[model samples]
Target: RTSIPINSVDQAIGAIRTKIIFGGLVISVLAAVLGLFVSRRIARPIGQIRTWAESIARGQFQYRPSITASEEIEALSVSLSRMAEELRERIDTVIRQRNEIEAVLSSMVEGVVALDMEERLISMNQAACRMLGIRMSDMQGRSIQELVRSTMLHQFVNDTLSSRKPTEMDIPLSSDGEVIVNCHGTLLRDAGGRQIGAVVVFNDVTRLRRLENIRREFVANVSHELKTPITAIKGFVETLRDGAVKNPKDADRFLTIIDKHVARLEAIVEDLLRLSRIEQGAEQGEIERIDSRISEILRTAVQVCHVRADAKQIGIEISCPEETRAWVDPPLLEQAMVNLLDNAINYSEEGKKVRIRVTQEEGGMVISVHDQGCGIEKKHLSRLFERFYRVDKARSRQLGGTGLGLAIAKHIVQAHAGRLTVESIPGRGSIFSIHLPTNPPRNGSASHGDPLQPS
Candidate 1:
């Protein structure tokens, strides 16, 4: 080994130190770049996943996150996307079911009300709001007592909830007891069969009740009317059998009285049969109709009642255009006009005037009979068209009136798809109008006329 110079050795050691330091520096730089790249690779996917999660929270299920750097991260993103889709499907199902339930509730005709366990109104349908005379928007979440003023309805709801069983009640809503509601209440339950609340359904039964009452009254009236004539006939027959037959004068007087009653009975039976036939024909769509001059029909009716008018000294006048025509059953319409004219003549005082007027009105033709007589009271107008309904029973009987004339007239008008209306003032006068529709409705679908009124 050659003796090395100190300068040379120092240079060599310095170079070695420089080389180590340079290598260490290069290693540190390369390690830092690798760490930075790895950090960015992990952070990018994480950031994208965080953004996707935020979008999902905002209900943006359609947003997808990009994560191709790491297989695990890509797998995680796919799983999260599936989860979001499932959540969306479940939410859609819930919304669909809710809409279906709402539709069912809205279309119901009967009034329906739902209450919570606390007796607060949860929901009410349109029919219920109308029946209770309340607004649905303002009634929600209110107590039942605050919404409905009826004690019976309140009790019914309470009973339904407390009993947890079905219950029924007939509640009267109107002050005059005209509006009656049949309520059926049942417990509301969840899918798990847990009692949640109560639901009440209301059906209007006022018309049904009125019809039932009319049926009962009709039976009673028929019985009384028939009994009166039969009892008289029986008594006269017994009198003839006992001793009156031996004396011709007494027998003749009794026989004449019996004949009068018999004649009245026959008239009643004939009128009843006519009404039955008219009703049957109207219901079966069998009443024959033809285009006829209404003036001719009115003239015929006047001719039929002229004798009665002469006896009462009631002057009759007809105001109609000869060109006026309508689709009508001639014989039936003539009978209706005859009944009205006879009534006008009978009810008029001596020298009173009975006027018949015909005119074209909107949607129909009107034939009105105006009588200058003791007009009907307002209280009796509504029932005047009912069979055997008389304002003055004793006076009607004394006049030899059968009490079936107005009823027959009404049926005939209805058969022609017409309405019978009356307006009267107690002391002024009365007008009975037959409103015949220009175009008749289908058979058996005749519109019931509005209730009679007093002017």
Candidate 2:
């Protein structure tokens, strides 16, 4: 090895140390820059995910996190987005089901009410509010006894709640008079099979009860009427069979009496059949109506009653305009008019005039029979048109009155959309009138005339 100068050797060693120090500085700067870029790449996605999670916690499910830096980050973002969508869908489904249940309850016709186990009113339908005469605002959280004044209804709710089973009852509410309601109650339970509430439904049955009472009364009256005439006929027949018919005069008298009873029975049966047919026709909407002159109907009825009037020495004086007309079933109108004329002739004193008057007034025509007879009492006038009803039963029987003629006449007039009314004073006379519309309204139409006023 060749020996070099010592100063030159020292300068070479310093130059190598400077170069190593420069290289170290450059490497340190590069490493610091790489660390900052990697940290930013990781923290940017993490920051975005945190923001999305906070928004979701605040019920903003529409927010979605996005991460494109790494596959793991992207997977996390997709999963979070799917979770938000699923949660929103489930919430939406629950809300829709709740609305559907509310809608179904609102549209019900029968009164419906729901109460919690604490006896607080949870919900009520429109019909329930109407039936109870209360508002929803007034009924909320109120106890059953507090809202409903009826003791029977309160007891029914209590019974349902205690039994945890369905119960039914008929309750009478007396506001104006008596209104009957059919109520049914059932326990409401949750998914855990735990009783949570009760639901009550109410249906109005007032008209049904009234109809039942009327039906019962009609049956009783009909039985009594039929028995009376049959008993009389049987007694007369028994008298004849017991040898009272041995003498010609006695036999003739008994035969005449029996014939009269038979005629009365025939009249009753005929009137009953006619009344039934009229009611059936009215109910089935099968009445055939036509425009007929009122004068002609009155004249025809007068002719039919001519022989009876002659026997009673009662003159039927008709006063009707020739041009007056009514919308009616012609045969039915004639029958009703004849019944009125016969009643007038039978009730009037001999030598008295039975005036048959027809007048057109106020969108309708009125045909009346005025008789000078023992007029009806005020109490009897209300029920004069009822079947088998009579003010003087003995006098009606003696005059061969079946007690159904007025009832038949009333029904016939009603079927024609007309009214049969009576005006009377006990000592003076009675006026029986039939009011018929000139242009009767069609069935189910609302623009109809007012009902007849009581006289």
Candidate 3:
């Protein structure tokens, strides 16, 4: 703070100012360089974290970054990584649950369909697609009406959306055919207990309904058949007791008529029992099988039916090689053959020729009986094997036929794991064929071979 000459003092102040300014400039330049280096060091890790966050945003949660910055930065990266891992695990769990649900729905036999609030198809299983005769790819997002075209199904969907309780009905579909499906409808709900959509389950009950109808018809037919003979016998017996007994000739004739009815009743009962036994054997796999010469079995069956054939003056001509053999239940097969021959004899006119032909086919052996008889109409052929089903009821009864011979034969062939089919042209002739597999299951083990051709 010493003052010299005025000019020198001013000069000294100016030199001090210049030096202070130079020193301040040097310090600022050095500080700026150091700050830049520090900023680069910090920004390197921050930029890497930013890149990692971007990848995570793009759904790359499994991606990792090598971040070796300050402890605070490292802790932050670790927390972010943990959060990403949790998010990834949650997403994987959701995907897995969705797949599991899809699998369960696909394997179900009953048809299942899911609809959104707007009645558009959200999901449909394979069975549902098959039942509805629609493709899943074509049906998705389509309205129920557009897919099904059934009034009852649409009503059911509306009911399902409005009501929480499940409802069921039989819906008839005319897509492929007259298919009857039993449908069960219920509302689908979300986790928050809100109504989200509806689900309908379909079960094909057409075969069950047909079987029920057949059972009812069978019961009715059996009752009618039994009542006819019973009523006839009762009426003849009452007539004999009233006045016919006073005359030996009338009494004898009434007794003979009663005897015929009794015999008819016995035949019906016996045939029914035989049918029941054959059905049980077929169901329980109790039909014992053995290798036997088909010609020998055929010959035996011919002998059993020769008496009836002789009465009708029908000549049965057999055409089977002696060496041809098959795995068959000999006694059962022989009985089946005898029944077929007897039926042919009963239906054939006097002096008619019946041909029994046996040949090895692509699938297996075939034993067919060609009869020059009154061929059945196409309508009656389908139910020819049904018990008590007769093509000509009056003629069948007049010929002392039990109306169960063909049914018994069919059951016998079925027990052998075979199919019995008939081909006939009206006013021409009839051919009844028994299609048997050559390599049938032996000793409780199935043996693969050519399958039966379509009939």
Candidate 4:
């Protein structure tokens, strides 16, 4: 209703517009500031939680999130901390179990190989590496066939994987030398019984096979030896019963021959028994050991064989220090020495010299019986100590030899932690020596003892 000038009215309108715009700008600024503070408060805790989660994913379970803004965030941090601790414990347990499995595999004497589902080698123990002639580094992640080059092994693994069943075979490897290994392959399965891989185990059976062969041969030899004497005795007895008993001279001769054969049979049986006893004693660890003068043992052996040497017209020579000492079983050592002396005397020609010598050698004492006789051939030396093994079977029987004396002597010496060896040249001479330890071990492991000076 009040009439104003146009300039004044326009100025008033501009002022009111300016004031409204200023008020709006101020309100917008206040809203922006409050929004920034609220957003920052929420984002800061979330950022910390995210960082903590990332750390956990990276296996940093030792780190903890610190959140103080909200109860929900604090509860989440606590839950996360507990989860990390449980995970760490479970991981440590897994690592410990893996280490224990590794230790058990390493200590095994038999070879063990583990392969992954991809047929790659995952683990191999020391014995496995040694048996296969490969290094651990070279075998890892490599195919089993590439490492072992054996058709049998490859087939075994494939069969086990395909059937999820165990398989076994004897594999012969001749890389470094001939080796027979008994291999067993089995499937490795997960907790759900799903086949994951294959495990192959190997055991060396070469020595066991050889021992079995020896046992068979020994049984055959014993049967033959026993049968021969029985057959001869039966044949001679039947001949006497048929007619020879009627003539006195023939009867007397037959009786003499039968008596000689009977005596020989008795000797053989006795010697076999003695050898068996000695071997049993050694195996049972029941050898009687004593410290005795070496000279005394040699003297006793010589005296026992003096009559035989005189009968054969052989001269006996002794060469040894007077007071040399050794650890030995007195009776067994005397028996061993006597057997050697008897062998030397029986094998020597008439008037040949048989020498009994004792000397201190490297870490031991050597007692040798030397004979100037028809010596042993090299081919016969390897089995010279075997029971009933004779270089000249007829000659040995003619000389009243049982063929078990050397075998018995060897066992006796071995029981005393000694070795028996022979050196000979055909038609020249033979020397049978017993190498005894100077100081025998109180336990059962003595082979060579401390060195001793000749007294």
> All predictions: root-mean-square deviation over Cα?
5.9, 7.9, 4.8, 4.7
lDDT: worst 10-residue window of model 2: 445-454
Compute the lDDT of residue 435 as modeled in candidate 4.
Answer: 93
lDDT for every model?
A: 0.88, 0.84, 0.89, 0.85
TM-score: model 2 vs. ground truth: 0.70
Off by over 4 Å in 3: 1-36, 175-177, 444-455
Candidate 1: global Cα-lDDT? 0.88
Candidate 3, residues 234-287, lDDT tens digits: the string is 999899879889999999999999999999999999999999999998788887
Write the residue-wise lDDT of candidate 1 on 356-454 in tens digits: 999899988999999987899999999999998889999888889888999999999999888999999877678999999766455534333323233
Ranking by TM-score: 3, 1, 4, 2
Itemize residue pairs with steric clashes in candidate 3: none
After superposition, the stretches of candidate 1 with alpha carbons farther than 4 Å from their true spots are: 1-40, 54-58, 66-69, 439-455
CA error at residue 6 for candidate 4, angstroms: 5.0
Clashing pairs in 4: none
TM-score of predicted structure 1: 0.86
357 in model 2: Cα distance from truth in Å?
Answer: 5.2
Kindly report which residue pairs in candidate 2 clash with one another: none
Question: For residue 25, what is the lDDT in candidate 4?
Answer: 97
- Candidate 3 is scored at a TM of 0.88
Candidate number with greatest TM-score:
3
